[model samples]
Target: MTRLRIVLADDHPLVLMGMRDLLEKDFSFEVTATLDSPTALVEHLRRHPAHVIITDYSMPGDETYGDGIRLVKYLRRHFPVPRVVVLTMVSNPMIISALYDAGVSAVVLKRHNLNEISAALHTLQAGRRYYPPGFQRDGAIDARNKFIGERINSLSPKEYEVLRHFVRGESMMQVAESLKRSIKTVSGQKISAMRKLNVQTDQELVAFCVTSGIFP
Candidate 1:
């Protein structure tokens, strides 16, 4: 059989070239194109479709959109959607679950190396769903503003981890333990974070995370 066609989209040039070299060397994949923007990737797809698209979630863009999540959704909606594999530093539950719901084929935390990408691609090619195990853990919520307009940061890296765990049915103690922190510390952080975000409870925080793209 012919090798599967693939494309890469990430703002990091070195990372993009490195991943391309790895995939082309190790797999039955033929990289058709590489791009730095989701918009450009979309335009390329209209001309020549690929079997898979490996995109970075944190790709830099104008103030309008930051991650490639929106691009994933667009592809899923357009006719002849290609299988998508999102590579991101973010492993938050809100984002992962939403991408899954949007028909993303795989979600891999970018911390994984070229070997992991090969494994993910192989698994998907074999007709199985792939989600990097242990995506979210009991994490704390950071309320420092991200400086993106008037929006408060809402969640720090650690806090986002806490938010993901709490939203996924974990409790305060469970979250603290998973995060290797004290219960009181986690509790205080959550409460303070909620206050800053103007949210009163865990459920509300979860809802906000999904809607505001704060953690997701």
Candidate 2:
């Protein structure tokens, strides 16, 4: 059996060390290189390509390859052969969707049991796509709607409260009064919620809430 060669990239040093230990100690996988930034990882890849690349979705880079979708796109385009596995704290559906479209072999959420990484690797070795557990379950009727629901779920409790009031036809000031929060606080929460859901306008945000069943 040919041993799997792996390359790793993450911004945090501790995370990089921990991942290397896990892969080498128990899995007996050969970790060719461990890097602290996407830029360094890309450089290492150019020098030494591996059978698989496990990377954090967000990593510090100078400008072009700084983070998220851009780095993922670069790896898929440049190397193309080494299967890509994203280990990330980001659960944003839109970003995850972009990674999938960019041809990532698997996505393992950092919050999930590390065992999920094992599962993702197994599936990838078999030539199948692996998502965070339960992402594809329940036979979701519409992918977009499902993603919207997930984005909503990612919001903070206060953010969700502000958004709920706005969806009920309340103005930002009105929501502030009802929630006993200052207008500025309510507005901030609303803005944060909108950013998380990737909506630019109040109308669009409320429409998303209604469509996703968060507002009825």
Best by lDDT: 2
Question: For candidate 2, lDDT tens digit of each residue in 22-110?
Answer: 77764537888988887888899989979889998655433546455556778989999899999987554555666788889889988
Clashing pairs in 1: 139-161, 139-162, 140-159, 141-159, 144-153, 145-153, 146-153
Stretches off by above 4 angstroms in model 2 are: 137-216
What TM-score, to 2 decimals, does candidate 2 have?
0.64
Tens digit of lDDT per residue, candidate 1, span 1-216?
Answer: 457799899888998899899888965988999998877787788899788888887654322333444556677777255788888866556657777887888888876666788888888889887888675454344544333212334344445555655765678987676566799988877777677677876678888767765544
| Local accuracy by lDDT, each model | 0.71, 0.76
Instruction: Compute the lDDT for candidate 1.
Output: 0.71
Task: Give the TM-score (vs. native) of candidate 1.
Answer: 0.63
- Provide the lowest-lDDT 10-residue window in model 2: 58-67
